[model samples]
Target: MQTQDSRARPLLIYLHGFLSSPQSFKCQLMREWLTANNPHIVFCAPQVLPYPAIAQQSLVGLLEGFLRSANCGPVGLLGSSMGGFWCTYLGERLHLPAVLINPAVRPSRFMPAYVGRVLRPYSGGTQEYRLTEADVDTMGRLEAELAQPLHSRYWLLSQRGDETLDYRDAENFYRSQRQTVEEGGDHGFQGFARYCAPIVEFLFNQQ
Candidate 1:
């Protein structure tokens, strides 16, 4: 199966969590694993914008660019936290398979705490942006998609010790899909490197 991919470069795009970047630990771990084991696969972890509307736009643009590139093959998504939420939106829209790690069920439900606060954006530089009502509203629109049944193409990875968001919400949200519920791990998700192989297999082998 690995050699078969040599004929066509399969892509694995990782989406980092909020206030995180392509260099985040999970992103780096995934990136490093792919580089060492799946040389035929193209790994992409775009630095998504902080704002909801533009973040979606950036993801879309990345996908488009990848699809247009030569030797493009099957595309899969892997997202953590907020990125997992956006990944669901994109995966459902395109009927693509995705691996979600501690995804936010309803971002708008807890987004109020972030509004109007001067927050550091991704890539963690000096520039900061205030979370606004418009950003939160855009998130609501994305959340609205959850009202319908989700495609059973997701592999959910959640930890009960997640302090920021409730693991139960994700369990209920993705009840129909595959999942891994671990105990005593925080929102960052402990020992994620352990699942690196299965994650690639699930995403890459999916149609």
Candidate 2:
């Protein structure tokens, strides 16, 4: 459920990377900054299910519930890594503005090898979740759903040196939309904060 402040201003829904949570460093930092700098903007980062099977409809339902619950007028989506994949899928259906960070464009093809069983790392904890093939297949189907042509309502941010996801994926996917490709940065961009200012400006400035 959304908080009271979320009722005001445009909605900003953040989707963290695979095996990550809303409590991620970037998510927390953005939350604090937005709360102080743009209190009117609603910030939502739900803790999504780890498995791909539940992740698909779960994420969509969450977004739908958020919009209905808050009565959000306009919405902006920010997604990182695998979450970026989800943002693309949702953007197709919602037609809302979005900012994708090191997004996983072809995760269906990328993660096929590990479809049966996979281990995920947890943040600040020595724990991992064992994923099932069903989960991976569902995620692949979700990616397929978003394989349509790109729209103008999307923006992509990626770094060439990302070790996790190939930067080319984002470049190709969002080629028609606004894009910012950084050189020599890792999967987690070292200068994410620098990009945040412009992203916020662009999102808020949009019609």
Candidate 3:
């Protein structure tokens, strides 16, 4: 990140995990915490579409547009689960730093099971999605887009007890990076709120 713009507030975009939304617990906690404690920081947690390709288009458009519309200051990225996959993609392309929480290392492997009509539980099951074989196959595009050493720009947080994802995958892949691997937390990254302040400090304050 460069010098603070002095024209607009710094921004932090939180990317929610698979089958999740901006309404997810962690996203809400981030929003509320910033509102109360760091109101100067701009926080955004867009509901990423389930489909891989479209989600990419929307997010890229959102971020690029935000930068074009305002002289914003430093930007931060935080992602969980599938969003972690995207946080890496976007962070790399934008040359920004990120903090990933139990992120999915190989979504294409498991996404095949989700290929077809899907119900998003986080959206009260109101959001109906169709996951295609093409979507499953395209997951690697984002993974392959990573151009830098994971340790150079990412801070990882994973737990051994994640039933949805194997924590070892992230631990091993992000090895040598600054990370925290807890003993018994689930895919939701147990006790996520405690790190909100520190996460902001890392993304906005650190190089």
Candidate with best lDDT: 1
Q: How far does residue 119 in candidate 2 sit from its true spot (Å)?
A: 3.0
Q: Give the candidates in order of TM-score, highest first.
A: 1, 3, 2
Comparing 1 and 3 on TM-score, the stronger one: 1
Q: Is candidate 1 or 2 superior in lDDT?
A: 1
Candidate 2 residues 1-207, lDDT tens each?
877754457778899987788888778888888888887787899876667767767877877876786465677889898888888888887676788999988776666565555456456455566766666677667676775476538888888999988788688878888888889899877778876667777766876
Residue pairs with colliding backbones in model 1 are none
- Writing each residue's lDDT as its tens digit, candidate 3 over 49-141 gives 888888999999988888776576788899999989888888777778889999998888888888876556575866688788888778867
lDDT of the structure predicted as candidate 2: 0.78
Candidate 3 global CA lDDT score: 0.85
Candidate 1 stretches greater than 4 Å from native:
1-6, 68-70
Model 3 residue runs over 4 Å out of place are: 1-6
TM-score winner, 2 or 3: 3
Q: Model 1, 52-168: lDDT tens per residue?
A: 888888787778777777767999999999999988988887777999999988888887888999889656688777788888999999788765579649999999999989999
Give the Cα lDDT of each candidate: 0.87, 0.78, 0.85
